[model samples]
Target: MTSDFVDVQIANRWLTSCLSLFGRVFGEDSAHYKRLNEQFPSYPKWPNVEQAYGVLLAAIDDFEKEALFSIKQLIEAEVFDEFLDQAEQLHSSGYFQPAAVVAGSVLEDGLRKLCGQHNVTLPDRPKLDWMNSELAKVGAYNKLIQKKVTALADIRNNAAHGNWGEFTSEDVTAMIRDIRDFMCRYFA
Candidate 1:
């Protein structure tokens, strides 16, 4: 494999190792579990730590895939041999909104999975409650995590729906930063 591939392999190894640690410490109800998910004890469907670890790991997988393989490279590398023709056709009509939607969905899914895994009671509607409640659990959102997260999702939707008039690379970078910040602050 290429050096980038090697590096990602190493990163995956370390990340998975950390996940094992999460399972050992908070796999079930424990101090970490209570701290992360005890705001509402009545909810019976809280997520377990392994599931949260899965979310984080999946995000890591996403980060790795997107970072390492450009759409063009994916085609040129023949890594998408089966979809090569379709992808090549897409190059003529590439869409940026899908990227934003994917990123937003990753954050949302990861956050919810983490919350449920930790036995946190997450609301079924008016999404972003995890951002609110989880941050409340640790005062991390006091740094305005919710505001940033909401902004990220809003932009993501606009971009996804083609309503975004104009967005710059900086906007995408900021969204990525906020997503990473929240992950680092709470999930990791």
Candidate 2:
């Protein structure tokens, strides 16, 4: 009976670990995670636990075979692309200030992801300049990129604070282009 109890505890721990990892990597909304989540037993019966373990193993195998790169990175890339596309639309519609703000947001998010990928510690509410500096210190990028990010951040700040005269539509266009390139270089 003692051995059985220990086994159950171990199985539960394994299930919890697998669920956490899958949720973090593929996201909870992913089909792989959802399927395994469905297989997890509420009661922790031996057979149910075994079945869930099997499902977890199979999900890992599927993920390994299907994803050549990090799924998180791929997902981030897709999201950034969509946002950049929206920024482009905004620029086309003569809403350059909002476009700059959106493009700046994408840049900031890309920097945060890079910081995570590089294992750089971030504050609770990290600013773009701070993230950029941390990433540079960790050798994620060079001084040139850091300076470019600073300029982009300034433009973003201007747009966010209603400094319309500080930057031009052409500046916003260039900002979006630079952000797209930056994301492709890092997140892609």
Candidate 3:
């Protein structure tokens, strides 16, 4: 398994916590502990340590996927994907201005969702920059990300204000890619 989403220190703590809990139930030197160790051999050692951590993370991911599927069954949130899809279609059809507007809306919605997830309060009718600032205050992203988001918001403003000469199709393509990556990183 890959360590792309795994942190060693965090994994160590989780494994330690798991061992402690299991120990309390099964006793440290019991046959159950031995059998469990056999299944997940090498607690805090290299290779196996990361492998064990990956397994734990994978299980969590599986659980999250199931939960999201169940939640979707109960409530529809089709706007998120629809906005991105419309942006992509507009961009592909050479309607750069409309594409940028839709893409900007996607980014704005993403920021709002991020804020809601973190329980960060936001002003009514908050703009992209304001949402970005709130997210930064809560440490959702760093300075570099803020700067990039600022640039995207600027392009978005130009597009929304009918400043078509300010950006080209190429620019919109980059914006769409950036938003896609941002969504995958934070919302996927």
Identify the leading candidate in terms of lDDT: 2
TM-score for all predictions?
0.41, 0.69, 0.59
In candidate 2, clashing pairs total 0
**List of clashing residue pairs for candidate 2:** none
lDDT of 1 by residue, 52-114 (tens): 445556545744676423433333234223232332333235544455555566566655655
Full-model lDDT for every candidate: 0.51, 0.86, 0.74
Candidate 1's C-alpha runs over 4 A off are 1-95, 117-119, 129-140
Point out where model 2 deviates above 4 Å: 1-55, 61-69
- Report how far residue 96 has shifted in candidate 3, in Å: 0.4
Better of 1 and 3 by TM-score: 3
At residue 87, what lDDT does model 3 achieve? 92
User: Which candidate should be chosen as best, given TM-score against the real structure?
Assistant: 2
Which digits, one per residue and each the tens of the lDDT, describe model 2 over residues 42-148? 55666666567677778768767866267767877999999999999999999999999999999988888888889998899999999999998999999999999
How large is the C-alpha RMSD of every model relative to the true structure? 19.5, 6.1, 14.8
TM-score, candidate 2, is 0.69
Q: Rank the candidates by lDDT, best first.
A: 2, 3, 1
At residue 186, give the lDDT of candidate 3: 75
* lDDT accuracy of residue 163 in candidate 3: 96
